[model samples]
Target: MSELRTEQPHDDAGLRDWQHVHNVIIPTHVLSLAEVRERAGRNHLEVAYLDDVLVGCSTVRPPTGDTLTATVIARTLPAHRGQGFGTELYARGVARARDLGAETIETVVLSSNEDGLRFAKKRGFVEIERYLLPGDTIPWIDLRLS
Candidate 1:
């Protein structure tokens, strides 16, 4: 059986593992350990551990007094993918945003990432806008949860 636990990004050694997994799972540029530390320090970041292993991480920035934008950089180990870890992470993030007094939560995903888009939609996030990435053909879709 798997269990989910939440903790601050800086306090979780498993965040490094999550970053490594993210680098392997996604096609986007991966953040270095130092960069991840800096982002966590600047934002409200959290990690989800399944049992004793790190499975997901999310970062939330307060873009405005009433708006929090969240970015989830998560990856389940190969053996653990497709087993609801991402959903767990997202649910935790939503709860955190509410606790932080955010009236809305926003996130962006590459249009090519169909799975991510579907997941976000399933979580009640609506597509708000789309923008082209500089010098790249890929388009990014912005999603918001209220």
Candidate 2:
């Protein structure tokens, strides 16, 4: 095991890798490459690797509106969980959010991802709300660090 290697998705390959992790982890909300490209234009997106293996990806949505709220979501592959990749990605995301002048931080998790929900709770995130998107059956939970 080695320290996780992460970089902003600047190339098409990097973008694809990021999108792969995201879509795999959040199967309920699969994103296409073009969708990822659009998100990259507004959000800070990064791909995480352990040596040459893809481990995860993270997103930091900078503070917006009057709340100064920023959103950080780290998605680790099922095979890569319990290896600290998510923790590293999350820490980097929080730091990036603060750097962008965020006053409040939050994260979202798919209801079915028990690991993700547990990860958020262990990090002092309290569930603020849970709601389903249009045409979705499973709900998404929104949590805020408290």
Top-lDDT structure, candidate number: 2
How high is the CA lDDT of each candidate model?
0.67, 0.94
lDDT of 1 by residue, 1-146 (tens): 65778777554465575466656655565668877677667677776677877666665664565344444433345566688887777766667766766677787777887777887888778889998766657788888864
Model 1 lowest lDDT segment of ten: 66-75
Give the TM-scores of the predictions, in the order they appear.
Answer: 0.77, 0.97
| Candidate 2 residue spans exceeding 4 A from truth | none
Return model 1's CA RMSD, one decimal. Answer: 2.9
Question: How many clashes show up per model?
Answer: 0, 0
Scored by Cα lDDT, where does model 2 land? 0.94
lDDT of 2 by residue, 1-146 (tens): 48899999999999999999988887778889999999999999999988989999999999998989999999899998998889999999999999999999999999999999999999999999999998778999999999
Per-residue lDDT of 2 in model 2: 86
lDDT of 2 at 95: 99
Q: Least lDDT summed over 10 consecutive residues: which range in candidate 2?
A: 22-31
